[model samples]
Target: MNSITVLGSGWLGFPLAQLLSKEFSIKLSTTSSSKFENLKDENIIPFIVDINNLNGDIDKFLSSDILIINIPSKNIDGFKELIKHILNSNIKKIVFISSISVLKDETTPLLEIENLFKKTNLEITILRFAGLIGYGRNPAKFFPNGKVVKDADTPVNMIHRDDCINIIQKVVKQDIFNETFNCVAPSHPTKKEFYTYCAKVSGLPVPTFDSSKNESNKKTVKSDLLVSKLNYTFIHEDLMKIVF
Candidate 1:
């Protein structure tokens, strides 16, 4: 069986590692030692890795055939050191869990670090996921009862955590690499429509939007490349259907 190492066992990484453990020999990394036994109970080999500090047995963690980096840290120097270690290790393929936020701003650290990974010789796939939703992470909760939310007309670029995991699984399983793809739902709904529905479903107070703000050039993300290249279908394509 092929071995895979998942760096940063947080929200998305933890569940991803759990699912991948059934098919591949999985090694999961966590910054906290408290989660070590939890990972073990799920049949995932655990490692205490802190990329920001460059601490832990990274060499051993990189022993797998494939590496999945899901950390939220944006430290350029830390990733620089991690990349150096990767070049020296047995990790031939990498699936980087980037964010669509990189497109929103050029100054974003993820874009700079992404460039660093692009120059490497190893096969790498960069998945830029939009605002993560699902698994009790409802967007409605972002606004309190009477909080005024802006961008009422602006379209929301978001993805479900389940779809995020499935897309990564497809990329790794199909050997898709050296490509950058946006992971977002095809349905682009207005923030007001989406959040109002979410709030009603979750029994939360509906957020009020500021209609005074005119959003002519609203930023919306598309997953055309992902759909075309991976031939993948999003499980949560309709944002309105998402229930908490």
Candidate 2:
């Protein structure tokens, strides 16, 4: 079985490792020692890694056929050091989890980090996900009660956690490398419509929207390339119908 190492064991990474462990030898890293026992209980090899300090035996952590980088850190210097270690390791493929926020803002460190990986000799696939929802991350709870939410008419760009995992799995299994794909759901519902429905379903107070603002230059991210290239169907294609 091919070995795969996950750099971060958070909301998306931990569950992804669990699913991938069935077919591949999975090694996962966490900054907290509290999660070590839990990871080992699930038959995942656990490593304590802190990229900010470049701590832990990263060389051993990278001793795998594939590496999935799911951390949220944007420390360029830390990645520079990590890239040096990656260049020296046996990792053949990499899947870097990026955010769609990079597309709207050029000042984000994520864009520069993406460029850094692209410059490398190793095979890399970058997945730029939209606003992550599903499970405990409900969009309805984003704002407090009676808060005026802007962009009521603007369409929302979101992807479920399940779809994100599935997309990563497909990319790795299909050997799609040296490419970047925007991972988002097929539907683009207005923020007002979607969030109101979410609040009702969750039994939360519905948020108020600013009626004065115009819907000009609305941003809606699509996963057209990801869908066509992977030929994959999303588990939660319709965000309005998503529950938990």
Candidate 3:
């Protein structure tokens, strides 16, 4: 059996471990002690680890064939030490769960971290995910009644949490390494239409968007590379189905 160590076990990582545990031996970590029992009960070897302040035998957490970096952190001060530790370990492959925010015109700290990983010739796969939505993370709650937002006509790039997990699994199983995958739903729903439907379905007040905003300001992330490269299909491609 293949052993995989997931560095962070939060909203996306916890469910990901649950789904992959059936086949692969999952060694999961969390920053919270309260989650240990639940993870252990699910047959996951749980460890309390904080990436920002890493302590204990780092080897114990990384003693696996593969490592999945799921922690979302803006601090990269200790990141070099973390990289050194991973390089010293026997673990060879890495799957870094990144956000699409790095693509924005502004320079982001995550991009710097990613560039550092690219500099090292390690077998790493960077999965840049779009706005994540599913279960408790409904987009309807973000905009309140009579709230005015900008860039209403821009395309919304989003993916269901389930799809994110599925895409990660596919990348691991296929041994896809040293590549970047934009993990997003194929549907390109305009912000106005999508959020309007969300508010209507959830009985929330519909928010208005400024139509005068420049179209160039809006950003749309494409996952054509992910689809073609991974040969994967999205389960929830339409935002309409997502709202209902």
lDDT tens readout by residue for model 1, 58-173: 89989999999999999999999999999999999999999998887899999999999999999999999999998878898898768897878889899999999999999998
lDDT of 3 by residue, 1-244 (tens): 2999998888999989988898888889888889865444455788888878889757788888999999888678767778888888888899999999888844888998888788886899999999989878888878766678678888889899989999999999999998998888888888898888888898878887887778675777889999999888898988778853
How much does candidate 1 score in TM-score?
A: 0.96
lDDT of 3 at 231: 88
Worst 10 residues of 3 by lDDT: 35-44
lDDT (Cα, tens digit) per residue for candidate 2, span 1-244 = 3899999999999999999998988889999989866444455899999999876589998999999999999999999999999999998789999999988899999999999999999899999999999879999999885888887888999999989999999998999988899998999998899999999999999999975666554888888888889998989989889875
What Cα-based lDDT does every candidate model obtain? 0.90, 0.90, 0.85
Q: Count the backbone clashes (under 3 Å) in each candidate.
A: 0, 1, 0
Q: What is the TM-score of each candidate against the true structure?
A: 0.96, 0.96, 0.94
Give the poorly placed runs of model 1, Cα more than 4 Å off: 40-42, 214-217
Extract clashing residue pairs from model 3. Answer: none
Off by over 4 Å in 2: 40-42, 214-217
